[model samples]
Target: MARTLHLGAFLHGVGHHSAAWRHPESAAERLGDIAFFEESARVAEKGLLDAVFFADGHSVNRTYTAGTTWFLEPITALSAMARATSHIGLVTTVSSSFWTPFHAARMLASLDHISGGRAGANIVTSMFDAEARNHGFDALPAHAERYARAAEFVEALTALWDSWGEDALLVDR
Candidate 1:
């Protein structure tokens, strides 16, 4: 089998460098604009990249002075990216801790439809007590608990997504 390297771009404001926003040519003013995001996706598509990825979190965790709290909500932004590109995949990080399995599955499934089957989700068992606190927990769940919940959540998601096959509407059952 021939080995192939898959490449994807992580879209952040201007760049990923900590000081990117400080650079004069970084176009820092366009941070939340969807056009900026679309352009990034379009470029990736032109470059024949496999996908464009967005990382998301439940809580704001950044130093105020440096201003790293720049994230457009992933699902919504990816929807826009879907419209702007034809072939490149749209992938987003979904924190399992923040969403019920059914809800997350529905959202991601819809994205797959919207993207013409190019949607992908990176389900994450989120870390950090601060992230947990925002979701009404005092502290991060125990390590085992986190993974356990994530495992169960994934099982539920798979079941939900797989519930209706192409022949699901047949009366042969």
Candidate 2:
């Protein structure tokens, strides 16, 4: 059997560069448009890509002076994208440091069901102080502490995901 290479597109605010929004060809004003995301995902699917990924943060990055700074929530945006494409996977960055395990598990599980198992999550311990503040932390936790919490968070999330048996959702009507 031959090995296969997987390619995933990281959709970040019109483009990846901070100045992406300033480019004449960029859809700067339509960053929040579901149609834009749907089109991008469709294009990625046309190229036979494995997945489309979105990175998310709770707080705005103050460093960017001129660029698309805000965005639709990742899972929410991906749900819409899932409806527009059939084969490509939908993945999003979910900050373990900010979201409770139950919430994360339910959201991911729902997305997984929606996409017929094409949903993926990149769980992250957020690095920004602003994100911490938004989550009610006065300062970012120490690196080790954050990782420790992340480990526990992942364990709990996995347990929650596993709690539902394979046949749990059987609709026998």
Best by TM-score: 2
Candidate 2 stretches with Cα past 4 Å from truth are 64-66, 169-173
| Window of ten residues with lowest summed lDDT in model 2 | 61-70
Lowest summed lDDT across 10 adjacent residues in model 1 is found at 61-70
Please, what are the lDDT tens digits per residue for candidate 1 over residues 1-173? 99999999988656777777888778688888899899999999999899999877777766432544446888998999999999999999988877899899999999999999999989898867788998898988888988899999999999999999978677875
List TM-scores for all candidates, in order.
Answer: 0.91, 0.94
lDDT against the true structure, per candidate, is 0.86, 0.89
Q: Which residue pairs show collisions in model 1?
A: none
Cα lDDT for residue 124, model 1?
A: 91
Candidate No. with top lDDT: 2
Evaluated at residue 32, the lDDT of candidate 1 is 89
